[model samples]
Target: MSEEKERQAANEWKVGPVAFISLLVAILFFSGLFMKIDGMKWLSAFDFTTLGGTFGTMKEPAKNTFLGAGGVSAKAGFLFALSLVPTVMLALGCLEIFSHYGAIRAAHKLLTPFLKPLLGIPGLTGLALITDLQSTDAGAALSKELYDQKQITKKELVIMGAWQYSGAGLINNYFAIGSALFAALTAPVIIPLVLMFVLKFVGALFVRFVLNVVYKEDFRNEQ
Candidate 1:
């Protein structure tokens, strides 16, 4: 964590009820739950996926924009990743507004008690980690933003990457793809999700331990 950033945020905003509420709204906005509902499409207005929308198909339904269907290898991968640029930009824009109002600071303060102790990363990173549950691209973008702002150290960034990479976009990927195999599985659907979520923390902690023990000299100057 960057001490300067912490002090700056502390001076900029007082963590209060409004700040807390703002953080809640920001979290829900990216959580994907509100993107669609059985009978309530209006809620999509507040959802990140809905707000980000999707790329339009050209003549053929599968061929969207320059990236056509049945593509493979690195070229296809790059194009697929490129499509997420819009959502990432939009998420960062929204985050800036929330941060301006002190929601990000409040999130940092509120999550500090656990996040600092558990992962040794700044509490402000909670937003990014939570976002990963729904959108991997957005979470990664948020993490990059934090690093670019000099808010988290390189070690902290590595720890966060460990947490995120464990089950990147777990909720979205699981529910979307796993639902098809739900009937074939022996266990309940929620069980696997719970395990994977827990493992994200475990993986982060393990990485933290390794960094402290094996690579301590690399970050000797950092806190």
Candidate 2:
């Protein structure tokens, strides 16, 4: 009976991880397709004359102000893309600060009790799971830490990979790039965002369901 339990646990671990990674890859590929089809050329279509006057013709505009005495340059589109750089840099810096302070560890402890049973993951796995929601790199780093500590098995890592891939760091991308596309195309911004969220939610649930089905016998034996 003990042997059967061990086997079942192992199988459950394997199924979850495998399904997670596959779903993540699919989401990324589709996101790329959506971006390409949404008309990204608007970034280069700004006209400075429409704003007020040509660049360098305006009086000194304060750094914080968008418009000058002559008017704002027709660089709205370019400026929007440029804005993403600072946001990304800020996110990376914040992540580093969080890691330095061991904030992830504290978060893990706080989340572990609730998540461990539901996800069938180790207490520390919470850190990686939450980080995955924020950013893929952060999640990957956390996963590696857990793996190195022997806190999670190969199967668990695979599941984390799948989950992170699906929509990890997606919020930033949506606001930065996706929003830009919506503005350019004059499309209903809420629709695409909602659709993407629904797809990701459904995909994650589907993957979890498949894992449960595939490993049901093993899980039952474990119980």
Candidate 3:
């Protein structure tokens, strides 16, 4: 490639870890983690009295119990988030283990014929793509591996990007959060559940179409 072309390629490929950190910080700020919202009372409608005792009698309990409970809840949330860190690390570790055992290679061989034609992605890309469904950072690291190994070209990476950009592992998220947190029988649950699946399917299809269009020439060459 020419120097100009190389420079352009380098400029196009950039990862902004700081941007991700900033997003987390912003979410914490807005979610009343750092500062409470003015003039907004939380859980004001909760009928604690139904459990027994008037508001005045409950004042001490509310102050002591509620505050203590709030601390526990916050700690639990923090721990939940922390728990993901190790899970993610373990996932990446497992990926490495699979790679070492030749499982990934076997999977690539088994899946290539089907995926190559339908998605225009190499069979090997499937491993990374699958991992991406579990974790974005992990998927990204796998994609970087493919790039570094010359298994996928830069142009092909762009095409893959289209498909990977949309939310992956949505089904897992739905089951983990939607079903687990809120009982499936909760009021009007079916509609939201169905809608989430539909949206995920549509989003995946849309990305496939866009990638196909964007990489039409490259795909044609492959054909």
Candidate 4:
């Protein structure tokens, strides 16, 4: 009985059934296997086209309207929201795989030095944060996951949120619409892009100061 007890204690750190299943689910879903399997066909119910159409219809004016400004806004918002789905899935899916393989722990050790001073978040969270710069939805989703796991506190969330929203999806959105949107600005568009990146970090710092100084929420101690 003593030997059995010792073995149980030794295996305590091994990956559990739930974690294994989570990793599997992340892999299957992201790889599109779930959609292919008839048993999991229901998962594909998250139809972006239908969702976008619904939003466009709902935003149509009360009076007779055929895709006017409101409809356009709705479509744009839908597409924008849809654009984030893949990034969020891919990032979170990779996170699950990394977590299962203990890569997150390794990454945390390596990233702590740089991320500690800049983001005030755990080294493990660096993956999500970087993904946020490219896709706000992915970043925000990953942030929520980290918070739910108790890896970060509410104060840290606020700081990351500020940084994310200030200039989230910077690269994708810029290349998608920057040219036509700022045609008159010409070469000066580069200035705004650079400023946006700078301001995101600045906003993060401001939030950190507010939380650390005013609220006395010290993340260094929390970690």
Could you say which candidate leads in lDDT? 1
Cα error, candidate 4, residue 58 (Å): 16
Report, for every candidate in turn, its global Cα lDDT versus the true structure. 0.88, 0.51, 0.53, 0.64
91-113: candidate 1 lDDT, tens digit per residue: 89999988877788888898989
Which tens-of-lDDT digit does each residue in 1-223 have in candidate 3?
6999999866543324443343333223212222223564452222111111122345455355433545566766776566455544654565565555454455455567976776656666766665554455556766777787787876557656655566654434444466765654656765765675455445655666875677566556532
**Residue 187 miss distance in model 3 (angstroms):** 12
For candidate 4, the per-residue lDDT at 45 reads 46
lDDT of 4 by residue, 3-62 (tens): 999999566434555544544443333333233346766665432211222223455365
Query: Evaluated with TM-score, which candidate comes out highest?
Result: 1
In lDDT terms, how accurate is model 2?
A: 0.51
Tell me each candidate's TM-score: 0.86, 0.43, 0.46, 0.57
In candidate 1, which residue ranges exceed 4 Å CA deviation? Answer: 1-10, 55-78
Question: Which parts of model 2 have CA positions greater than 4 angstroms off?
Answer: 1-105, 184-201, 215-223
lDDT (tens digit, per residue) of candidate 2 on 1-223: 9999999866444433334343343233223332333466342222111111123433545543444233355676566446445434443444445444444444445456855555545555654554454445545766776677676766556556666777666655676556757657656777766676556545555555666788655445332
Residue runs of model 4 more than 4 Å from their true location after superposition: 1-87, 101-103, 181-191, 217-223
lDDT, candidate 2, residue 161?
68
Error of 4 at 116 (Å): 1.4
